[model samples]
Target chain A: MTVNIISISQITSYLRELLENDVMLSDIWVLGEVSNLKRASSGHYYFTLKDDAAALDVAMWRTYTSRLTHNLQNGDAVLAHGRVSIYEPSGRLQFYVDMLQPAGVGLLHARFEELKQRLAAEGLFDESRKRPLPPLPHRIGIATSAQAAALRDILTVLARRYPLVEVVLSPCLVQGERAPDSISAALYRLYAQDVDLIILARGGGSIEDLWCFNEEIVARTVFASPVPVITGVGHETDTTIVDYVADVRAATPSAAAEQAVPDMAVLAEAVTVLRQQLDEAMSAQLWMHQNALHSATATLQRQNPALWLARSRQQVDDLVQRATRQVRYLTERRQLQLDGLRQQLITLSPYATLHRGYAVVQRTSDGGVVTAPAQVQRGERLRLTLRAGELAAVAAPPAPIEEQHTDD
Target chain B: MTETSTETYETLYTRLQETVAQLEVGNLPLAEALALYEQGVQLAAACQRLLDSAELRVQQLQSDQPDDQ
Candidate 1:
């Protein structure tokens, strides 16, 4: 009845309002196979939702497209939830997707598994290829977005745990289409550095946000890194392909930092233990040597040469005293005997007889005994001997004898 | 064992260990034993000094970059 010359815009605007006002169409769920999928450079997603029976047009703006967990492709069965709306200008009816999910099993998950199996079959995730991390790494290379909170967390933990480690930040994008190449480049850059280890890290995110780490190129690059790579790409629940290919896997960025370096407190404690061991070992050794020295000193004192010499000197002195006493006694005894003999001789001497008033005459010529007075010559000289003096007389020996007798 | 002050912590610790082992044998002559003991003491002291004086050091690498894949 409104065929009363109504314009096409008015009719389309009226239809758009009618379609938007329908509560069932305003918010609804549609099950279909995706077709004609296209991503505009402006980040919008355009596609057709179709089944064996019917078809529908779909459009997801950039904000909603960015939230998609899986990449849409032709003939992917999905459950799309959004509103039906009409464009007045083009007079087109379309479904604006707010949320999209795989119809039964997620196709992206299947692709992830597919890629994982293929890579695993190719030996990219071989355990034998994994390398041991350096015990004390001096240089640690980090591949992460500089603006990410994950980087801040890693830096904070590293500074707290091991400030001695040199940190080389190889910045890259952590998500979106360019993330794979950016991450691969960052890993390659780190591999060229003189680093002992590498840490590829990212904060927790949705599956799509974490998709870069699951990329085959990122995984292969991490697998081929010269230095051992440690991956901390998401929360504990998120596992990426790079995580499997890396030498080590950590649950969080802070955990990666923990694995990359040693704690200073622990090392300090080790040094302290070593010092204690040294002290105990040295003290025990010194005590052992001291005990040995004491025993040696005791043995030396037992055979002391000074003590032996002193004992020998005392023995020599005692022998000298005995010999001196024996010599003195013998000399005294002989002197006494000699003195007695001299007394006897003195008592029997002729001089003693003269003292007792006896006299004898002798020949002056030969001093023969004057027993025979007639043998004396008148001119011969004779001598009289006394204890104190000697006298000489000639020819008058008789008178001299008389005078000697009188004097005696 | 190095007696120079520039000895590293690892080197100093290793020498201190060796000195301790030598002293533990205890069969050297008196003068030699005393000298070794003195050296061991110094080594232990030097190890302590090395640990004490060492401060954590950090640096950044430069000059190498790879093309984006």
Candidate 2:
């Protein structure tokens, strides 16, 4: 063995290092009754945690003291969490507490944190795995204590929001040691009935009372449910593993029921809106057809035979008027030509030539004109003609040829 | 006794929605559109009837009862 000389500071420092480095002592929780509790002007807390066997000195820094949920008093059982270390100045073991809670609750909270981390690592609480609740659930299965006020609240909400849904309650123990198994069994029972949705609910209670909702068995059952689940366990502040695994988390049991189904009034209003849309759509379609028919009728009127006949009649009347005017002009031209021809005929008449001539002689017996004295016999008859009269005469002839020639 | 029908409110509502959508397209013939309008009116009435006549029914299972399915 080697002997070494050291001062008090050195020994205290060594002891502090040894105690601080010890894994089990560095971070731990100890349950004991609080004794000699004191608050200093620095906002630090000094107390002694004692049991039947022994006592330990505890100190909480000002930063941690503000986090204390409960005021410390003498003889109150508490679970204090901190590191055990040797105080260098006094070379004494002291618990430097950072957290203090009621004994059982503190222990339960530790287990809860551990389980939450383990389950979260397994992806049990993944948001992607969360199922969407049905917009209109036909049947909603409720898993809760039959005698619990949560059940009444859920029922009242369901009745008010959506009376169309059929509610099936699978009653179970919501507290105590057997509650975890009871809750899981209730979930299976609801599943067997083929519920469209499920509501897991419990009224507000102590952490111990609500411990079953935090149980692994209940969480697994909720995660495995065929339908989507809505969880409303404990109060708004009390969250559990089931809430993490459920599809929807509500603040209270009534809220869970509300989440399970849609309101009838809203559905009715939607139906009315849809009906109105249908009416408007149908009216628009009809109007379009009516307009099309109107245009078609107008087009048909333009092509009507009656209108074509009227146009043709007008054309015929115009032609008749032109034909009458042309006939009148031709008649007038023909009359004028006839009158001029008659006047020319009058100028060329033979009677006019006779009017200008002298008298002429003719033999009456033969109706021959005589020009010489020998043309008639000794007792021949002769006739004289003028322009307007005729005369008859007798002639004697006994002249010699020489004498007749001399007369010519 | 409750008047129970084979058609659910969801089914009727879905049909009503489809009918409205088809009508909104505005391409169907007059007779066809008229028939669809009549069908949509009936579907809407059926939905409203279901909603109006609804009553919440609550039942509890015996904890110790065996599965009787």
Candidate 3:
């Protein structure tokens, strides 16, 4: 029996036409890990999507490459939706990608990384632009589904942590197709009110389930929030785009609540400690002032001017007595010297000579003394001088002495 | 009662500051001084109550949220 053979080109052409025209194939979804990635100079990316057993060649054009946010590497798990075609030259089967979504965090993580890098380069996550959380939030607006465990956890924690904290709930779909829009709207509503803080919370889910939070709308909304927003989107291990953009990222809803309010016990202790310190400081300062006053009093007591004045007055009185004694001694010595001078004057007096029985002779004329005969001019001048007084007499010259010898 | 008690604690603190200064001035009579000292004890009790209230608040912030705890 003879068998008919078809041309290889014809078969390849027909398959290509079918794949290109078929809408279902045009929107095919394949799940695998990426291997053997090749990027061209034209900024297009070529790589193989694979798992443990099978692999498929994938291509993302320059436009899609530019839009990609994460890095692609070997062994990346991803769910790619695109049309299948044969490269005419290499004749290899390849999936030309239009829209690429990561399968798990592994594949999408690469895209996520790429997007993060690009956005980071644009400074979307700059530290300078990041805002600080309020010290104590008053009106807390919660953005999550009413049925979500995240909401319950947050509410319970808030109620217990700070019972008086006013909670304003704005319900929204946390996951699924409508989650992004719902979250965005919820944030808008919360912002419109005067809330101190807004918590965007959701329970843990798979990458796809939490994809809405990673949407551009949600990220922008979180970034543009006027009131500080805290994201408690999942468990501690899970990270979402919302977490990156939020003002604060908490490990869980309860933890977020814990962050929002100060612990009552710790605050109380701090207040008490401060009060004690204030007391000690004030007491120490007061004591210091009192001691200063005491020192001043002691100094004044020891050196009282009035006491010194009393002592000085005593010294003045003693000096006055000593001065009076010195004056009396000096006056007595002066009187003794005056009495000796009076005795000398008395010895020099003529009456004192008369008492010694001394007589003086003088001529009667002008009471001249007859010391020589020439001075006694005969009887013309003669006088006798006595210590007591003077008397008139005739001198007889030198013959008077001789005549007196004859009479004897 | 709680609210009034809290108010008393604040009033006591304020009065203690003033009265302690006045006593230190030493112009008051012996009787007046003894009376103020007794009042000081009451004010100290009020301050302790306020401190106790604050301790509860501090404990809440420092410890794990009850669910996690």
Task: In model 3, state the lDDT of residue A247.
Answer: 79
Q: Which of 1 and 3 is the better model by TM-score? A: 1
DockQ of each: 0.13, 0.45, 0.08
Q: For candidate 1, give the docking quality class from DockQ.
A: incorrect
| Candidate 1 collision pairs | A361-A370
Candidate 1 lDDT, A1-408, residue by residue in tens: 566788898899889889999999987778899999999999998999999998889998999888888877888889888899986667889999987888764545656777898999999888998898886676789888877899889989887776656678888889889889888877787887788899999999988899888889898898788889999989999999988898999999999989888776776676566556656655676677789889999999979989889989999999999999999999999999999999999999888977765655555568787665566777777666555556676754456577889898
Clashing residue pairs found in predicted model 2: none
For candidate 3, give the lDDT of residue B11.
Answer: 52
Question: Best candidate, lDDT-wise?
Answer: 2
User: For residues A240-358, what per-residue lDDT tens digits would candidate 2 score against the true structure?
Assistant: 98899898999889888877889888999999999999999999999999999999999999999999999999999999999999999999999999999987887687545557885
lDDT of 3 by residue, A3-117 (tens): 8888888788877887788888776767887778888999998998887787778888999878766776677667676788887666678899876655664456555665666
Model 3 chain A worst lDDT run, 10 consecutive residues: A273-282
Task: List candidate 2 stretches off by more than 4 Å.
Answer: A1-27, A33-41, A47-57, A71-75, A91-93, A308-408, B1-5, B65-69
Fnat computed for model 1? 0.22
What is the lDDT for A196 in model 2?
90
How high is the DockQ of candidate 1?
0.13
Number of the top TM-score candidate: 2
